[model samples]
Target: MSDSSQLPYRPCAGVMLVNQAGKVFVGQRIDSTLDAWQMPQGGIDDGEDAETAALREIGEETGIDPSLVRIVARARHELFYDLPSDLIGKVWKGRYRGQRQHWFLARFTGTDDDVKIDTDHPEFRAWKWAEPSELPAMIVPFKRKLYEDVIAEFAPWLESIA
Candidate 1:
């Protein structure tokens, strides 16, 4: 087996999309049988800036148009997470150890009707608006700490708009 330590982390962008009521968006992944839920995120394309990648991910994953959301705050630094050992060779074609992500906080300006998860390629089987504090518990275990850190960095903005 290839040593996971020798692998690089994937470059990714993530978004914590909150609604006017302060509830954040979490989606149950279509690919996972587990009850894992996560915010919109995906690998950043080459030459795409993190913010642009973040907006694209939201539209790709949730089918929510960029015009329906407003970017609020960005995490001060990238957050890193390692995939579980068992998954290291199975995911991302075994090219990545995990992910190093740039995360953004966006506010959903449109009503609930605007969210349509059945996009050209849907990532989530189901989606919901969740309380910000519930993020860590909702995510897959490997990404829980990363979610917590995102909430911490965006806490002030989350509160101000609440």
Candidate 2:
């Protein structure tokens, strides 16, 4: 990840998918990839809206239809991490510079069987549900604060869901 502070904030959206068991969905990045587990997120495309991007990212990453999920909250956070030196060249192909993510919370209403890893884009290799507090250790350090904001905002809902 690029140093988020150095890069500047770009508009983005993330989705936290929580199940009835109180476990939130997390995806293990592809091997030697970003080297972190994360909720679904992506940059907002020009002419595309934030909610649209959030729904799109969730579907692309987890194969879950946005319609099957309910939006519980929308949280905003700015994160800065050094761009992995190797990927400095392949940035999002535009003027993004860095990611300014708007995170969303959702609960899965559909069966889990539909989730699959896409070999072409290959964002995540493995996935599992875990307690929200367990996330910081598994996420990229630069992005941990965003998860913190998310968890803090959702802690009460998490209890309610439980």
Candidate 3:
């Protein structure tokens, strides 16, 4: 296998949208059959700031407007994860080997009614609120490490409200 450096990592932003109860939102992807769930995330568009991209991703994936969330915290640095070897050349038009993501923690001020998963370009088919501690097990195996890191980085903020 070629070293990961041979392919660039996708620049992406992830949002950990938490409600008043402090549970994070997770979605079942429309493109996968494994029943894996994930927080809102997407590519960072050219010329867009990470925070703005994160908010945009939330809106695009969850149909929740940016106005509904209150920023809680942001990771001090981007986190990297390599795609599985079989996925290295199949996903993202083979442009990226994996994702290097900047994750944001945001509190959902709006009620559950505000979340509409059926967006114009829906990435998820179903969704729910789950304990942040359950994230690692809920995500796809390939993304577990990234989810674990997300929990670690966002733990204090989650605890503050719990």
Candidate 4:
């Protein structure tokens, strides 16, 4: 196998969507058997900027309209996480070692009724609002540190809402 270090990190965007209650959105991945939950995130398409990709991903995954969310703050810098060795060749066609993600914090202006996880191509089987501090523990092991960094980067904004 080619060295994972030699592989490129996929460019992606992530969202930390928090409601008025300061709880963040998390979803159980439809494709994962593990009890892993994650915020809305996906690859950045050609010519699309990170912030735009973040919004688009949120709409695609959660069926939340862009108008229903207010962009709060973006992470100071991009964060990265590596895929576990066993998953390296099984995901993303083996082209990427993991993801380098630009994350955004957005406030959900609509109620829970606004969230619909049954999009045409749904990524999540279930979704919920979670406490910010619980983020790292809820995600896949490989992504725990990345979630921690996201929570840290948005700490001030998260605290202000709480």
RMSD of each: 0.7, 3.4, 1.2, 0.7
Give the TM-score comparing model 3 with the true structure, all chains together: 0.96
Model 1 spans > 4 angstroms off: none
Displacement of the residue 104 alpha carbon in candidate 3, Å: 0.5
The global C-alpha lDDT for each of the candidates, from Candidate 1 onward, is 0.93, 0.75, 0.91, 0.95
TM-score, one value per model: 0.98, 0.81, 0.96, 0.98
Record all residue pairs in model 3 with backbone atoms less than 3 Å apart, i.e. clashing: none
lDDT of 4: 0.95
Local lDDT at 59 for model 1: 95
Local accuracy of candidate 1 as per-residue lDDT tens digits, 87-156: 9989999999999999999989999899999999889999999999999998999999999999999988
Model 3 segments beyond 4 Å from truth?
A: 1-4
Decide which is better by lDDT, 2 or 4: 4
Ranking by TM-score: 4, 1, 3, 2
Residue runs of model 2 more than 4 Å from their true location after superposition: 1-7, 31-35, 76-90, 93-97
lDDT of 2 by residue, 11-102 (tens): 78888788888788899877556668988888788999888898998888888877888887776444433444554546666334556677
Higher-lDDT candidate among 1 and 2? 1
Model 3 lDDT tens row, 1-162: 566568889999998989989899999999999979999998999999999999989999998988998888999899988888888778898888899999999989998899999999999999999999999999989999999999999888897753
Alpha carbon lDDT of residue 16, candidate 4? 96
Deviation of model 1 at 100, angstroms: 0.4
